[model samples]
Target chain A: MHELSIAKNIIEIVKESVEEKDLSEVDKVVLKIGDLSGVVPASLLFSLEAITNNTELENAGYEVINVPFIVKCNTCGKESNNEAGIVRCTLCGSNDTGIISGNELLVSEIILKN
Target chain B: MSVITVERKILAKNDEIAEQNRELLKQNDVFTINLVSSPGSGKTSLLEKTISLIGSKVNISVIEGDVQTSLDAERVANYNVPVVSIVTNGACHLEAKLVQDAINNLDLAKTELLFIENVGNLVCPAGFDLGEEMKIVVVSTTEGDDKPLKYPKMFRNSDVMIINKIDLIPYVNCDISKLKDNALLINPGLKIFEVSCTSGEGIKEWCNWLIENVKGKYIHQTQLVY
Candidate 1:
C-alpha cells in the first residue's frame, strides 16, 4: 500500500534527525494526520513497524493524532469542522468558503534517547 | 542523558524532492500530466487511444508506475514511443523521488509531453505531488457516480476528470450528469470529458484539447522572449 512508502519516508526523516542530534535510539514518533490528508493511521503504523525492523527505530512507539478538517465560511463568517466535505456555510448555507486547516500529514514530534 | 523534542513533518524530505522535480519540468518547457485512477479505469487504453490520435504530431513519452508487472509499459512500447516502467514492488502510489529518477533515465530533450501513469488507487496518490503540470483523474461510469462525494480529495486535487467507459452506460446504470455535478461541486473549474476508449468516442476532442493547451502555453512563453 502507499502507507509503506509513506512509512519509508518517515523512517528516513527520523533516521536523519536522530543522526544529526547524535541520538542512539528513537523512543517515539508522534504524527499528525489530518482527516483530509487521505492517510489511515493504523495502516501507516503497520507499515512503519515492518520497515523499521532492525533499524534504530525498531523499538520506537508510534503516536498518531487525528486532525479534523476545519473551514471558514466567507459569506456567513462561520467557522466549523467540515467532516462531511461540504463547503456550505452552516449559518447562511452559502457555498462560498475557505479551508482553514486539515489536509496535513506531518511528524509533530520525535522523542530520542541518549 | 537528555530527551530532545524534534518537531518536524515526516514528509518534508519528500516534499523537497517533489519541488525540485517541479522546477526541472518547468525549466525543460515540458508539460507533464500525472494520470490517476482505479484499476481497469481505461488509463492505459485511453493512453493508447491518445497516442494513436496525436502521437505523430506531438512528441510524447510515458513513465508507467505499477506495483509489479511491466505489462502496461509493454502495451505502450508497441506504439514505438519511449516508455519507462517503474515497478513499485507492491507500493500503491508513485512518489516524487521516483518520478525524478525516471525523468533522469529518460531523454527530456525531445519530449514535449510526459505522462506518468500512477499505480491505480483513489486515495494515497492524491496526497503526493509528482511535480506534474496537471493532474488528470479518470473515473469510469462502471465505478459509479458517487466517487466524487466519497473521495472528495482526489476530485478536488484533479484539474480534469475523465469519465471513461461511456459505451458501457447502456449496459450499466450510471448517471453522467450526477457525476459531472458532483465533480463540479468539488472543483468548480474542473474540466470534464466523457469518453469510451474502446469505441473511440470523444477521444479526438480530448486529444485536441491537450495539444492546444500545451502548444498555447509554448507559444505564450516564446512570445515573452521578445
Candidate 2:
C-alpha cells in the first residue's frame, strides 16, 4: 500500500522531533487522520508497524484520531456530513458545498522518555 | 516522560518540496500539469495525442512515474520530447522529491509546458503534490461512472477532469453525463473535458484549453520579464 510512504513520512517527522529533544527513546505518537483523507487507518497502522522495525519508532506505540468530514453549503451556509462520498448539503439540497475538515493527516503528539 | 503535541502534518516535507518545484517552474515560465488516473485510464494515450497534435507548436517535456516500468517513458520518448521516467519501485504516487529529481534532468529553460504523469493511482496520488499548476484526473468510459464516488479524494483535489475513451461509450454500460454529474457532486467547480484519443473526437477542444491556459498567462509574464 502507499501507506508505507506515509508511514515513512511519519517516521521521519518523529525522528526529527526525537533528535531535536536528544532522546533515544520515544514512547508514543498520536496522529490525527481525517475520514476523507483517503488513507485507510488500518493500512497505515500496518505499514507504520512494518517500517518502524528496529528504528526509533519500533518500540513506540501509535494512535490515530479519526476526524469527521464536515462541509459547509455555499448557498445556504449549512454544514453537513460529507462521509457518504456525495457532498450535497443536507439542509439545502445544494451541491455547492466546501469541505472544511476531514482531509487532515498530521502527527499531533509524540511522547518521549525523560 | 512527557508528551509533546507537535500537530505537524506528516506530508509537510512533501508540500515544502512541491512549493519549491512550483516556484522553480514559475521562474522558468513553464506551466506544469500533474496528470493522475487509475491503471488503464488512458493517461499515456492522452499525452501522446496531445503531443502529436501540438508537439511542433509547444516545447513540452514529460516526467513519467510508474511503479516498475519505463515502458511508458519509452512510449512518450517516441514523440521526440524530453521525457524522464521515475520508477518508484512499489510506491503508489509521485512525491515532490521525485519530481524535483526528475526536473533536474529536464531542460526547463526551453520547455514551456510540463506534464508529470503520476503513477496510475487515483487514491494515493491525490494526497501528494508535485508542484503542478493543475491536477487533472483522467477516467475512461470503461471504468464506470461512479468512479468519482469511489475515489473522491482524487476528484476533489483535481482542478480538471478528463473523461477519456468516449469512443467506447456506445459499447459500454456507462453514461457520460453520470460521470460528469458524479464529479460535479464532489467538486462543483471542476472543469470537465470529454475526449477519445483513438477517434480524435474532442481532442482539439481539450488541447486548445491546455494551450490557452499555458500560453495566455505565459505571454503576459514573459513580456513583463522582457
Best by TM-score: 2
Instruction: Score residue B9 of candidate 2 by CA lDDT.
Output: 91
Off by over 4 Å in 1: A19-25, A88-93, A112-114, B1-5, B220-226
For each candidate, C-alpha RMSD in Å? 3.8, 3.5
Highest-DockQ candidate? 2
How well does candidate 2 score on lDDT at residue B123? 91
Model 1, B1-226: lDDT tens digits are 3454666766777778988988988888789999999899989999999997888878899999999999999999899889999999987889898999999988887888999999999887888889898999999999988888888888888999999999999888789999888787666678999899989888877887888777887554222110
Task: Say which candidate scores most in lDDT.
Answer: 2
TM-score of chain A of each: 0.89, 0.88
Candidate 2 to truth, TM: 0.94
Candidate 2 lDDT, B73-123, residue by residue in tens: 999999999999999998888999999999999999999999999999889
lDDT of 1 at A107: 76
What overall lDDT goes with each candidate model?
A: 0.83, 0.89
Writing each residue's lDDT as its tens digit, candidate 2 over A1-114 gives 779889989988887777744445788889999878888989999998898787546778888898998998899998887664568887878987778888899999988876
TM-score of chain A, model number 1: 0.89
For model 2, the local distance difference test gives: 0.89
